[model samples]
Target chain A: MSRLFRLYEKKRGGRRTGSKTVGSFGEALFFGIFFVVGCGTMAYMLVALAWPEWRANRQFEETTCVLVGKRVGSKETAEGEPVQFRPEFALKYEAAGRAREADGVYDVTNLYSSDEAGVKSVIEQFEVGKKYPCWYDPLDPQRVVLVRGYSLWLYVSLLIPLSFIVIGGGRMIYELAHWNASEERRSVLDSAAAVDWFEAEAGERHFPNVPDGSNQTNSPGTKLAYRLPISATFGWTLFAAMAACILWNALVAGFVVMVVRDIALGEPDWVMALTLLPFAAGGVWLIVYFSRQILVATGVGPTRLEISDHPLVPGMPYEVFLSQAGRLNMRSLEVWLACDERATYHQGTDTRTEIRRVYEYRCFVREDFEIPQGLPFESRCQVQVPEGAMHSFLAIYNEVSWKLIVRGHVKGRPKFEREFQIVVHPALAGQLVS
Target chain B: MMDPRLSLMLDEPQRTFRPGELLAGQFFLEGVRPEEIRAVEVSVLWHTEGKGDEDMAVHFFERIDPDLDDVVDLRQPRRLSTVLPNSPLSYHGQIVKIRWCVRVRAFFWHGKELAAEVPFQLGAVPRPQEAPV
Candidate 1:
């Protein structure tokens, strides 16, 4: 019983490197669905093949019959009304040397045309008093047909469901035969190799104002004077999802159009259009929602962080300024200096950055303010670089930085957050010289 | 057996120098013939070492082989001098450390070599404790 439900096999060596079961639940379920659907469809094909052969080879008496009636008809389906002209073939025939009368069509398949002219053309060939060939089985004289042939459409319909069975069953067999835990160990080695490669590639990163051989490590191209816990303005993930939804809806709509065209040709496939209505409506809503988020994030202004002197030396005091303009409507405004340690590494297909704050010092705060409408405000403050602090520096995979953070709250519109980067160099002069 | 038998040392009392200061050093060879001693070179340079990637730069370098061809012993030492550059003061930090040094290398007759390094402090001065920041 324990072996039957086991999930992990005993490891022969260092790592857990063996399979505990013959097949996963998914593999079993897929194979079961495959056989159930595949066998059912194959049974239908077999019946179609056998029934035609039986009727053709059976001893049936051949006789002549006279056509008696014909007309057009209409029916209702899920998509729309399917108007087709159907011929009700009435005929008179004899069997077992006895005179008898019969009235019915030979073709059991309900083949209909959208136009009345199609049925008219077929019925016109057989006049009301004309004689046509008929076949009646001797064992059952009442079982007679004007036509005796196989239905090709019954075999054609197997193509769609058969494809699903092949895919599901093939995947299940492959999983049971060759699936193992080797890929798990390979991924571990791959991750370490990728990290080393990313470090080497990142070493060539060029920033603004950084001289080629200068003793200084600060790059002039560091755009933001500060770093944030989250980059709230980038909505790229949601935007990509919106794009995928639009593409899918386009494909589905194109399929519906083709199906609608076939319904016009008497296929009666209006149910397809009805099935697509909900997905089309939901796609429009998703497009609107994601577009709004993207526009607002890109369009809004970030409360700015300004420094009096960038690359200031330690043991020196510097001025910091914060400003915002045009309809802020903020409930709170604040600015602070923060020291951060950032580490970057590669994980699978993604490059991840981790940030931890070493310290923070608030420089200004304005929780309550009564500014007139259409007014802009600027605030100035001072922050001193500590004497023995570590200077701003960047390595391939590690960084030590100082940045100013600005935060603002508003009842309406997006809450504002921004950061500005600053570099602090060690102070010059030894104790004896001073 | 062909390795150079030489000793190099800085002549300054404190073994320290500041920006724009002229650096001076000396080296003595042990019973080496003039034909055996091929060349002598001296350089003032700075290099970084620590958790981060290391980088180095040469502020001054001179090969004295072409101008002088003479042997020297402990009684009469060869002289080396160079003026220093500004910036990049010798710094000691939590994750990185940079040091300034004068290096001497003597070239012998048959692919032989001897080298020595004399480190010195460079900066205005260390800041005092309890000073306002």
Candidate 2:
């Protein structure tokens, strides 16, 4: 029985303590969201491309015109002069009462004449015989033009915004999957250990804290573990938003296509709901997203540090003190000093120290040695602190400032940097000048 | 040695024409180099100041010679006169002298090489009158 139990323990040990099933589910969910959003965006673009043709075929008619006359001279002067003249073929159409009413009455009268003399003058100036392309509805043969073509650029321009939605949605889904998988594994391990007699024999079995399991090294809960759900929520919200946007775009395209088809079929007066509704909604969403991001960035509290008031001369031992001032604690903090090229360090005195202040989430301690005669009065010194650490140093040295560098991942969010300057007083200058 | 360039002096008709009226002018070209010139083509080009350091306008070529000789190398000043726009110019009965300059180019070797160009302003012409109703 002892040997059999040993074999069983070995076999159980080989099995991963975490739940593989949960991890897989999380990964599948992530990939599913990514695929749906990406494909939807591509479909929206393709629908937009076909929209113009759908509109054109539904309303306008094809017609023909003969070159009457050329628009001569500069664009400015060509207006008063007959820009184009109706050819003889157009005369036949005019005789047959086929001339369409010119669209803008005022511009037509001011720019082109309607009288026979004007027509004759235009025809005389015409290259005599040239065929021009025009479009008109068969029902109303009067509408015609010297130029006709569909502008394809309108539909092509939709790709830019669609691409952004796809990229942002894909990245969010990836992060969500990673968080979900890790959470599942953690729960599985906790359950497996709880079932083991040896682990449960003690009042509380203490397992090595998994990386990103919980904030407290001693406790089972950690900030990293809690952040997984938060990340998932954010990812799902973004995915839903992207899906809605794609649907809104597709609906708008369909509506435009329907309206165009109606107009082409000669239902010119058919009124459809203004398609601008979706565009307006999209604009509002963009504004909200931007404002939310800005608010989050500003609400992350400032970094604070403490510094001792003393002259830091080259080749001298100066005790530069540091501490945090804000409620938030930082993961890492650092300081760097630079002096003139001719400066030299004192033997065994040039050293850098980093101290993770115990129990001080908002505070840390560090000590650095000043190279003897290493820095001159005119030289520059720089102090750098990572994001989330509060600095009291910016207040002490009037000339020196705290510059925040990289803010590490906390809630799957990026780090930010800020700089503050401290001033050195005239009284303290003499100590360092010597 | 004289440079192979042409200089011109233009004089406009004493009156201006209406909006659709055509204006006429006389332009004379004098050769700086004593070289033979085959044929001379006159054109009325519009002129305007461009944004940068240049001028912008169009040149409307109007042939004055109905029968331009194949070649006539000239060492002395020559004179020819004809209508402003004929079949070759093809800009007849149209306004060509709005803010205009008369440019004359001497063609040589069956129109292979242009010997010289002479440009001169035609002071504003009288606007054409409306025919009595």
Each predicted complex: what DockQ? Answer: 0.02, 0.00
Error of 2 at A298 (Å): 24
Q: What are the per-residue Cα lDDT tens digits for candidate 1 across B1-133?
A: 4534777788786977765678887877765666666666677776655443444555566555632744343325878887665445665543445678887776676756667788997754343222232
The candidate scoring highest on lDDT is 1
Interface RMSD of each: 11.2, 41.8
Residues A81-188 of candidate 1: C-alpha lDDT, one tens digit per residue? 766656557777888788767665655343565777877776677778788888877777766677666666756766756876687677666555434322222222
Query: Under CAPRI classification, how is model 1 graded?
Result: incorrect
lDDT score at residue A344, model 1, on the 0-100 scale: 57
Off by over 4 Å in 1: A1-300, A305-311, A326-362, A365-373, A388-417, A422-434, B1-3, B12-17, B66-75, B124-133
Cα TM-score per model: 0.40, 0.18
Error of 2 at B88 (Å): 91
lDDT of 2 at A67: 46
| Candidate 2 lDDT score at position A155 | 49
lDDT for B54 in candidate 1 is 43
In order, candidate lDDTs are 0.60, 0.35
The digit string of per-residue lDDT tens for model 2 on A252-339 reads 6676677778788988434363555556577567556644444434443433322332222222332223322333333434433311
Whole-model lDDT, candidate 2? 0.35
